[model samples]
Every structure is written in C-alpha cells, then in structure tokens.
Target: MRAPAANPREPRRHHYVPRLLMKRFAVERRPGQFQIQAFDKSNDRVFATAIENIAVESDFNALERDGVRVSLEAGMGKIESAAAEPIARIVQGGTLVGMTMEDRAAIDLFCALQFARGTGMRAQFSALAEGVEARARAIVGADARLDLVGDAEGMKAAALQLIVGSLLEFTGRFNDKDLLLLQAIEGEDFLLGDNPVAMQNARQFGPYGNIGLGVPGIEIYMPISSRFSLAYWCPTLLHQMREGAALADQRLLQARAMSVVGQGVTRAAALAALPEIEALRARLRRIPDGHLAGAAVAADAGNVTRLNSLQVRWAERFVMSRDGGFDIARRMIADDSAFRQGMRPRLD
Candidate 1:
C-alpha cells in the first residue's frame, strides 16, 4: 500500500510577511533558507532575522520564555510570552491566525487586488483582478466539479461574493458599536483637523476605543487582516493629481483614500447586506467538485475586461463629502500641483 498524496492546492510553507518586504531589507540566500537584515536609520541599529521553508506539524511549540509558551496548531498560531503580548493582541482574532496555507493564498490574492488599486495604475489593477479570478477558478476547479463555460460567470460572481461574505462574517463577529467605531477610526480624516488633540481625544473615548481587552490604543493599530477585509468591499481610487506633485505624497494620498472607502462601506449598507452575503456563501459551497481542465485559463482575458469595468463603475459611484474635517486634511497634505487639481475624486 502507498501513502496518500498531499493536497496539491496547499503551499509547502507559509510566510507572515510577503516577499515584497525584502525590498526594505538586505537579504542573503544561504543553502535552504534566507537571512534578512534591516538597518534602522532613526535608531542607528541593525536587526537580523532568518526564514526557511519547513514542514510544520498540526500542533507544535513555537516559542517559550519566562515560563510562558506559544504554539501553532490546527490553523491557530499563538504567542504566550509576556514580552510578545502586543503581537498577540494585534493578531488575536485575525483571519490569518487559523487559516491554512492554501486559504492564505486565496486571501492574499484578494489583497493583491487591493494593493494593485493602491498603485493608481489601471493596467495593474486589471491584471491583478484577472489574476485573482484565474486563481479562484483553478482552486475551485481543483476542489470540485463544474462546467467552465456554463459556470465561469457564476464562479466569478461566487468568488467575489465569497470574498465579501468572508469579510462580513469577520465583521459580524464584533458588536455593532465596535463595528461602527472601527469603521470611523479607519477613516482617512479621522485623526486630521484643526484640533488634532481634540480628534485624538474623541477617538480615545469612542465606543470601541477602550474595547480591546488589556490592549490600550489597540484601535489605532487595526490588524492587517481587517485592512484586507475592508479592501475586498471597496473600490480603488485613481491618482488624478496634477503633474509635479511628489510621487511619495501621491502614494500616501492613494493609500489613505483606499482606507477611507474600505471603512466607509462597513456602515449601515454593509450591515444590511449580511443576509445576501450568507446566501452567496451558501451558493458557493453548493457547487459540485471536479477539475474544469482549461476553463480557468480560457476565462482570463474576459475576466480582466470585466474586472476593469467593475472597478471603473464602482469608482464613479463613490463620492466623498468635503464638508467634514477631511477637506482640511486633504488640503494640508496636498502639494501645490494637487491643490490646483482641485480635489480629484476621493477613492472612498
């Protein structure tokens, strides 16, 4: 008798930070692993770390210190060191904490779509969207039976719905007031205005401000997972600032705009769509299992076009109000070139 084969869809290893992070670090490949080092310019210190691809057991000790121990098992990874409490708090209920390698890839695919939009490049955005659809098709086909042509559109819809549904599921786990505050804090102009102190104070006492157990200021540092969750539901903004604006400033504006839109969607409208999200997930799960052969590749070109159209429509419909403190913040950050452009549409 032969042993069973491992799931082909599963990745051989997992990385908390993607390879892009290497851009900020000096990396050296050694035998089977990589040593990464970063120099902190402000502190004049060097930090070094190593990573490697290795088989992780379903359950195993990760780290231990001062009689405290952390473990990773069954999709859940934890750190119990008192010194690591901050890390623990930030990641406590993240979708990534317990997710398998394959699922992480799916989530990352969706994240890439968000990042692509942040790039303010139309071509990049379309490419990423098509990539996501193609990946989703491959994963779905591998796990289930389906007719590519007959169900390609349906599958694409299902994939989008699944992304949104999963995000809703995560949001649903929190209380209403907490959810509301989370949305507000994540807003682009939340901390901006004439009175920065007053704004900060307001956030400190907001509904979800003191909610994170034993984690002071947790609201200010939302988990990366939440960012992606919001990204899935929002449209990306284009960089329409006038020429001569600093590229770095434009990039920051794009990021903040993306955050605002993502957070904005979490309000009443998203809550009202909870039932629809559930239905979408249910429908996605009902698809039969089998390989769809070349269906995934066949739909790539069409999906790219569809994705671009969807993004454009979403961007057009999204309007940002200038009455709030947001106007002041935008003007403060805008370069002379951008000011002349006169408030190009807010990404959110």
Candidate 2:
C-alpha cells in the first residue's frame, strides 16, 4: 500500500526531522521488472527494493507519481529534469557492479544478506536523534577528512549528502569489500562488559564478529552487494597524503594476490594496449564539452580506454601493493621487480 501524503511538498532546508521520503517507485523496464528502493536519509542506506512492474499503490508509488517537489492544487506542479543517471542494467538476481564475475551465482543470497544489514541498521537508528548525531560524530572523528561534521550544516539531507560525498571520496581506493567491512563494523554489537578489546576492537577486523552471520546496528555502515568498488579508485581522494592507491587496505591485499600469482591479471593485457588506450583518451581530451552528443560518443570511447588504462594501473598497483612500496614514483617502480618490492608505486 502507498504511504499517505505527509505534506504537499517534500521538506527542504529543514532540521533533522525523522521523515521517511519513500524511495521505492515503479520504473518499469520490461513487463514485469520494476526498480524499487528504500533510501533512508537519516541512516544513509540505499537499498534496491525491486519487484515486478508493480501494481501496488504504496507511499513510494505516490512519491514517484508526485516527486519530492510540493504539489499545488491551485497552481501548477513544476517538473524538472533529473540529474541522476539510471542504472544502465540491473544484473540478474541484482548483482551490483564491481563484484568479481567469478561470484555471480549467489545473487539472491548476497542481496538477502545486504537487506538484512541495511534493514537492521536503519531500524536501530530510526529513533534516537541523538544517536543519529552520535553516528554522524563517528564519521567526523579526529581523523576524519571529508570535513563532514563541519561542512553544510542545519539540513539533514545536506549533512547526509556531504557524508556520502566523503565516503565516496574516502572509499575511492579501497574495494567495495572494504566498505562492506566498514558496514560490518557498523552492524556488529559493540560492548565490553568485562573485556575491553574484543568487544571494542573485534568489529573492525573481520572473522571476529562473523563476516556474514550478523547485521549491523546502523544502516549507513551496513553491507551491500556493491563491495570493493573503490578499492582501486580515487586514491588521491581516499588518502590525501598516503602516497599511492595501495594505501587502501583492500588494494594492498589485491597487490599481494597479484604478486603471489606472478602476473596473470588481465591488467597486463590492458597495459599492453596502453598506447591505444592513451590515444583514445587523448581524442577524448580534444572534446570541449562533457554533455554534447558527440561528447558522449567521445566519452564512451574515452571511458573504455580509461578503464583499460585503469586496469593497467590497477595491475601495477596490485603488484606494488604486494610489495612494501610506500611512495608514488616513476621509472623504477614501473619496472616489475621494483614494483614487487621497492620504493613508491607509480601513478599516471
């Protein structure tokens, strides 16, 4: 069933009110498949709640029909273009992008696990506005860099968006699995009745709190199927001063894996094709606009080349990660053995 209209217009520039903006709506791609999601802003959880081209009249459906904009009975309801991009394709059983192709069979199993975490975590924090504040505090701790605590205050949505921006920036280099690890950290129950360490420190490290057995107390930190996505991306943003992308834990692990296997990664093939990729990237550089139709074509081709180049860097980063390299250098590190054990990892 659809939620009754709370107000004619969605809240804007408002303080932290625990309002649930129904996220699920019917976006029919085919006859039976519809995309539905419940994005809890207060908890920062965005989960896809997909079903067949639904016929139900739920709050989400109402929200979709009547967008976040306020409706005007006496006036015209304004329509504006959406800035967000729709998912190009929803993988079967809903495999979020970036998961290893080797692990595609467990789609339903994976989503169920994610739902459990996001559901449990959001529920736990739905109340306790103070708890919400505290959670926000954890994100903006002494070591926090996204400046989430200070930037763009007063509005809950803005604060949450800033938090997302920061997370997007922070998790850039780490894999989605690492973020999943953080999600696991958020979900696990942390209390030390007698002991101070395991109860306090166990959640941060996997296996201790059980990787798949439990759900987190907070949704923002809950696990999702899109794991390890940032493990090899946005290194500069993730660690402003950390030298290389491998500074992120998961990337380091991948580097180790590459080192052990002795270079069978597709990254090598991608790197071998660098001149072609770079030439494509250079062609993209010539395009003046980021939104023109021709620009889109240029971008599509550029993105492929970039992806290939990124694959090469990722492979080298993988090797570099395996070694104890801490700097971002060139020439020496680019070489295999040096990448295997010496100075900084190369960037560019």
Candidate 3:
C-alpha cells in the first residue's frame, strides 16, 4: 500500500488530457510542473499555454462569480426560461452529433460540487470546466466522419460516458433511482461501473466477437479503483442490482465470480483487489451484527460458504426493494431466534 501523504493535500490531483487531443498541443514537463502549449485547431494558431497547479485567486473568483451569477439569475427568473431552450438544444444536438453533453455536464457539476464541499479538485476542474464543452464539441465534430457505432469515435464517446458515470457514482450522486432511470434509458446491459462481477466477466470473456463489428453498442471497462469507490457511494444501488429481479441470474453469477476472485488473490494480488472485498465488507456491515466481530469470525474460521451466504443475505436486506425474497432476508436478519438458528431453506 502507498503510504499516506504528510500533507492531506500534498499530492495534487492530476488531470490527463488525452493523447489524441494532446497532439494538438505542445506539451512539456518541467522539474516540478507540467506545461501545455495549446493551439486552436480551427486556426492552427497558439491559443494559450497552461502550467499545471498554477492559478491566481482571480481565476477562481471569476469562475465562482460566474456560478453565483448564474444561480442568482436563475433564482430571479431572468435566465431560467432562456436556459431551458439552450439546454434542450445542447442535449438534442449532442445526441445527434454523438457528443455526450450529459457526460460533460456531469463532470463539470461533480467537480464544482466537490470544490463547494471543500474536497478540492477545485484547481484542476475549475480550469477544465472553462473549455470542456468547447473541447468536447471539437472532438465530436472532428470524429463525426468516422463510424458512430464501433469506430474510434464511438469508443471515445463510450469512454466519456463511462468516466462521467464513474465520477457521478464516486461522488455520491448515483442512487438506486438513478440506476432505475439508467436501466430504463440505456437498457439493462448498460455497463455499470459498480458491478465488479460483471466487469470482471467482461475482462475474462474478452471483447465479444460482435463488439466493434457494428453492434449497436459496446461495453467499456472501468478501472477497478472507480468500482471500488462506488461501494462507498452506492451500496444501495449495488444491493438493489445484486438482488433485484431485473438481472437476477447474471447478478448472482457475477457475485459468485467475485467471491472466487476474492478467494484466489495472493497477498500482493489481494492488495489490488482489496477494494472489491472492502466494498463487499462495507455492504455486509450495513446489516445488524454484520461487522468484523460477526462476519470476520466466520471468515477467520474458514467458513467461506457461510460468510458468502451472510453477505448475500445482508445485501438482500440492506436494500430490499419489494417483498419476495427480500422479506425473508429481512426476517432472517431481524429476528434473533432466526439469526441464531440460521437462515432457512425455501421450498417454494
């Protein structure tokens, strides 16, 4: 494990401009800072030079003032009506142009939220929020001639959506309701970054043959760290998806696969996969008597089967949407007698 930094803010967050886009600029790494010589692709002329971690108070003040001004204008109803039309245009144009306005908006919104919450990715995102929309438009416009379904253009769009989705879930903006909406909007097979089992399966299965061959969509694999982060924010969503009837068999299979992966990791390997286990542990801990003392005891005793059962049951109750199996899980966890006697087998 990496040691914690002395200063909580010692390691400043870094934002990577993709290489495809970076080629449009001159980039250099100085001793303690990085520099970018950005150019306007339209005119092929230098536009600006950006040095990382360098910002003046006025820069932040300007952005803050803009945010405040917009808010005040909206509240006063001066901008509210005008905002809707432009927003609708952005969404419609973005969809038809294969530009992900929602994704970019999510990034900008989350970054602002983080800054407002004093978590401080403020410098990084404040700068990004300035030109993100323009950059996204440039990218989409440039890639427009390429295939929209499975080409590099499509990959970039999917990647952006994945990143936005990951960030939203990471920042606690994702919820069970969001999951339901997402499922309805994008179909059940939409790649959920929080679903480690499904993600791992995708990696193991490799890119399906149909992938990139003109299928309507493609799955984008997210970094394990992002999925791990989801455990903190969307345990409820995870629980709902895990036990919900919508993707029951697939979810169960993925859960089992995750368990197997957890069992197989070596200490070094375990460090990497620790997040997923931690997520599982975090989800389990939501239940009464589901902490280290109770669940850990079973784990330490080599009762993997029992431990897994407990985890599944715990998740089932932690966010039971409707009755069905949920009621049984709830009763099993709530009733001391049932808890001590252990969960019963269902005959129905």
Q: What tens-digit string does per-residue lDDT give for candidate 2 at 1-348? A: 453455645532221100110111223456655444322222223344343211111221111222342222111011001101111122122223444432322322222222222112222223334354556667777354443233211233332333334433322212232111110112121110000001011234443342222222211221121111111112222233233322333444454455556466655654555555445444443322221121111224333223222222222121111111222323223554333221121111
The TM-score measured for candidate 3 stands at 0.19
Write down the RMSD of candidate 1 (Cα, Å). Answer: 26.6
Report the number of the highest-TM-score candidate: 2
Full-model lDDT for every candidate: 0.28, 0.26, 0.27
What's the lDDT for residue 271 in model 3?
55
Q: Model 3, 103-166: lDDT tens per residue?
A: 4344333322221221022222333333454455577875544322343323333433333345
**Per-residue alpha-carbon lDDT of candidate 1 for residues 1-348, written as tens digits (9 for 90 to 100):** 443443455443433233222211223465545444322212223344452321122212122334543222212211112213322222344222333444333433323322211112222233445565566678777565433333333333343343344533433222111110112213221111100001011125544443221233221111121111111111111111112224434544555455456466644454555455545433332211101110111113343233222222222111111121222222322433232211122211
lDDT for position 281 in model 2: 42
* Best of the two (2, 3) by TM-score: 2
State the weakest 10-residue window (summed lDDT) of model 1: 192-201
2 or 3, which is superior by lDDT? 3
Ranking of models by lDDT: 1, 3, 2
Would you list the clashing residue pairs of candidate 3?
Answer: none
